[model samples]
Target: LSTVHIESDNANNTLIAIGGDNVYLTFTPEEPLLLDSIVVTIAGLATTLTESNGSYTATLTLTGSEPDGILEFTIDFKDRAGNPGIQVTATTDESYVNHDIYPPEIEIISITSNNSDSTWAKVGDSVFVTFTASETLDNISITIAGVSSSYNELSVAKYQGYHVMDDSNDEGDIPFLITYTDLGGAIGPDADTTTNNTNVQFDKTVPEFSLTRMATNNVYGDSLAGIGSVDTLSFTISENQRDLNVELAGSQKTPEQEELNFITTHTFSESD
Candidate 1:
């Protein structure tokens, strides 16, 4: 002649406590429990709670890398003078999430003022962007100086909680137009949502360049010691290429056609 009952302190992931304290309730010495057990299930990362006498509680802290989800758990108490009965099976859930500080890389993957459509990202106008990239994404986004060009593109990626952008063009320096996208979704999307201005200032400085030689002649600066009128000396210096990338020139009917931007451009000859 007895009844059982159970209760949960937290319906979500929590530091569970009970009765001015906590109780991982159990039974012993005959008088079986109506509900004799409880299964503590949790998601994300959980640590066992320390027990004090019959009072205790536990904590489950979420990790920065924990994914979004839920953890279901059950509690069982037996029917006794203490009403060790599962009046209503106690239930709870734990949720996990990935806090990102940076947004996804809006790597102008493939942009061209070509068709009227521009993937929505306008040229001069600024706008916010968003994405769920994992962990707190803070710093991510590349600038093209508000200057538009075929060589410019946005690249967003997670190198180490950092949304990295490689605005590398084959040739010429593109004015850097930066729009920081941080902890929202992707890189730019996130930054757009949180920032006051969408697109900021542009890198106005035009890159410098010089002509070097790359040939097979030998007499002058050719790699071969003595084959042609070219010197056996090389004339290529490892350009700082810090912000430069390698690009191939596109074909055009006229020499005035737009030249593809690239970092390195070599000339061939046998002159002194």
Candidate 2:
């Protein structure tokens, strides 16, 4: 007699988390032959099987609070001819992990700051990034603008990180890659990908504004220093400023008073 196939539903060939349950073992013979009995050994427990219908089926139940380790299954059968067939055995590759495997779930919610919601941060400004995970991850990292940085766990399932933009960070949508591993060592599909996918923005320079107090300054060209009839005041802005308005103390100035036919506010816009 020759053994055809042997397996346990819980066995994944490498690791099996039986968790002290009844593992149904099935053994098929290469050809139909009279089988008197079958002895099966799982781990250290042994049992005899008598159920057969062209094959043999046995239920092996494990118990106790034993630590997870290597699992080996050995089967020995006797033919009706009172002859013993070849012994068949199957063991896990290394050790059996008898614990539930729950892959980690990670997501990047938002990367923004209190000053701006457009995901824009100036140099030396900390960009706060919010993250959520289903479970406590074993490893968590963030890759922004081609640079990778580790993260610190804050609470149970919430995590955040601060990424400071420097002169190296140009004006563009910075790609953010979050890689994480769960307690079971399971990672996402595109975990290590460095493509420009998820992203934030970085502004290297702060907006610069210059005021040219242009008024009827006599021949000396020293315009009225204080609150003079500020008629036709020339303004110069280094960069573009959005929602910009010229305010005096608390009141916002109208376009007529803030601008003239020759000069206006200098505004610039940049996108990544």
Query: Using lDDT as the measure, which candidate wins?
Result: 2
What is the per-residue lDDT of model 1 for residues 1-272, given as tens digits with 9 covering 90 to 100? 12222222333212332112122322122354333332233332333544344433334443324333233233334444555544332323222222332233433221122113322222333322232333333444433324331222223442211111223322232223334433332334322222222222222234454343434444454454432333211222223223233322221112111243222322333431
The alpha-carbon root-mean-square deviation between model 1 and the true structure, to one decimal in Å, is: 16.6
lDDT of 2 by residue, 1-272 (tens): 33333333443321344344445556676655455456776665775465556767656665634334444567776666757777777522222334333456764356665446445667776665667777676567776666665566788877776667778766777656677765545564334322224346676766666675545433445443333323344566666555657654233454433332224222212310
List all candidate RMSDs to the true structure. 16.6, 12.8
Q: Global lDDT of each model?
A: 0.30, 0.55
lDDT of 2 at 177: 66
